[model samples]
Target: MAAQSNAATAGTATVQGLLSELAALEDPQVRAVNERHGDDHGVNLGQLRAIAKRVKPQPALARELWATGDTAARLLSVLISRPKAFTAGELDAMVRQGPVPKVNDWLVNYVVKKSPHAQVLRPAWLADPDPVVAASGWALTSERVVKSPDGLDVDHLLAEIAEHMATAPQRLQWAMNHCLAQIGIELPEHRAQALDIGARLGVLKDHPTPPNCTSPYAPLWIKEILRRREAG
Candidate 1:
């Protein structure tokens, strides 16, 4: 009992210390900049990564940090947590929390993508009633479209994009657009159909992009990536 009490005390102190560190790192100016992009955190990603390096991987500690629900801390937790440790149900719960944009992006890329249950969860989440959860499912589908698409129904995916992408909620639309771009970039036989769908849908077609950066517009994005690959 004494040992358990002491261990709990130590864990509490550790989380508190990390929270203090994150607070110190926060900057009002950074917060303002991030808020424009729909992210609420103020700490720089590089600094968060550095902190993750200092903290040893501990799934319990990561869970505690995530439970704090502070964006910066949650980002750090993602960096240090063992991705495969989370069950499919836990991951589903996390996605439904509707974390701010950056947190959601990091959670999908850093943790959910690496989970052993990703494949099982993919189709289920894609069909979820919530747009955010459905967006996550689309994100995973985009990954498989590029990396491992043996059994994925390409025709069905394109048909869905044709039917829903133009009217999807903002985040879900973006994920569907990404999947459309990936299909064009990775699948030669389907390239014409992908390009035609992108041209007709015109999603993100005029979204401002910095000079020299590739546009997120699917047709343009697909073409630019193919150009780069050929140039290589």
Candidate 2:
């Protein structure tokens, strides 16, 4: 019992130390940049990744850091936590927490996608009332649209996008647009429909893109990616 108590105490001290490290790395300029992208953290992604590299994977530590509600710590937790260790319900609760865009994106991409529960959680989140949760669901669906699409209804997905892409919330629209692009890029039979729907809806058409970056406007994005593939 004493040994277990000591171990727990040591874990607490380690989490505190990591938190201090993250705080020290924070910068106002970094925070401003992240804020523009809808994230609240100030730590440079390179620095956060460096910290994750030094810290061995620890599920308990990940949980503690995530509970503290610091964006950078949460990002680190997503990196260090064992994805499959989380229960389906726990993942659901985490998504429903509506974390900032970067954290939510990382949690879904890095953690939830690897979970055995991903397929199980996908539909529930897709149907969830919360737009954020639904956006995550769409993100997962977009993955399936590329990697494991035998069971998905491509027509129905396009239908939904056609009906809702123009009016859905920002995050959800982005995710749905991604699914549309995946369909256009990966499946030849649906490419025409996907492109048509994208052209019709015009979502993200005016989104400011950095120089030389592909536009997120689905029609342009689809053509640009396809053009690159043809060039190579």
Candidate 3:
């Protein structure tokens, strides 16, 4: 029993150290945890979550960041970039910044790819009143929204996009293909619309501009989606 207790204590310290490191990790937070240099930048997400589960449950840094919404909080609340547990308000701000490419990149890569809170983000975003914010709702819905066994009211969403597609071609194009790549066409009608919109919008096209040279796969899907729409 004594030996077991000693082992547990050692493990606890290791876990806490790991969490603090992740709360500070940045660059590798993208690319699904930067396989080659994960150790250097920070630990991978799966390990972070597991360790956090065992440690004293602290409110996720994102929750505090959302409540605070200050610059220092943004820098300090590094865990907001992680999928572990995101505050709803911060999620709203990220989505609101949808029109900004940098914000989009952060939302898709850091927040969506790394975190599971996307599930919580989808529905609320889908219902946003503003088209730009609603565009983000569609954008993330395709990426992180968990597929429901019963299914989503995707037709209404598509109709909503189509209604605005001509006027807001660029945004509509991005949102549709975003869904297409992630959600796929399980629903034949939605898939047909998705492929049509995605292909028309150039949903799969690559862009000459890159966000970071080290990580080049930035927003090609959106470029392609737009291209297809322009051609059609």
Tell me the lDDT of candidate 2: 0.87
The sequence of per-residue lDDT tens digits that candidate 1 reaches over residues 66-167 is 898888888877887899899999999888874588888989988999999989999998888898889999999999998899999999999999999999
TM-score of model 1 (CA atoms) = 0.92
How does each model score on lDDT? 0.87, 0.87, 0.48
Q: Alpha carbon lDDT of residue 15, candidate 2? A: 68
Instruction: Per model, state how many residue pairs clash.
Output: 0, 0, 15
lDDT of 1: 0.87
Candidate 3 stretches greater than 4 Å from native = 1-80, 97-99, 112-117, 144-150, 180-186, 193-232
lDDT for each residue of candidate 3 in 1-232, tens digit (9 for 90 to 100): 3322322432343323433444453344453444342222333446444433443333453444434433223322343335556566656676564443433544555665455566576677666667656666676666543355245667666665545544554554556545554433344445556555544544335545555432111134434544566799
Name the 10 consecutive residues with the lowest summed lDDT in model 1: 1-10
Cα lDDT for residue 175, model 1? Answer: 93
In candidate 2, the residue pairs with backbone N, CA or C atoms under 3 Å apart (3 or more residues apart, or in different chains) clash, namely none
Runs of candidate 1 exceeding 4 Å displacement: 1-13
Consecutive 10-residue window with the lowest summed lDDT within model 3: 213-222
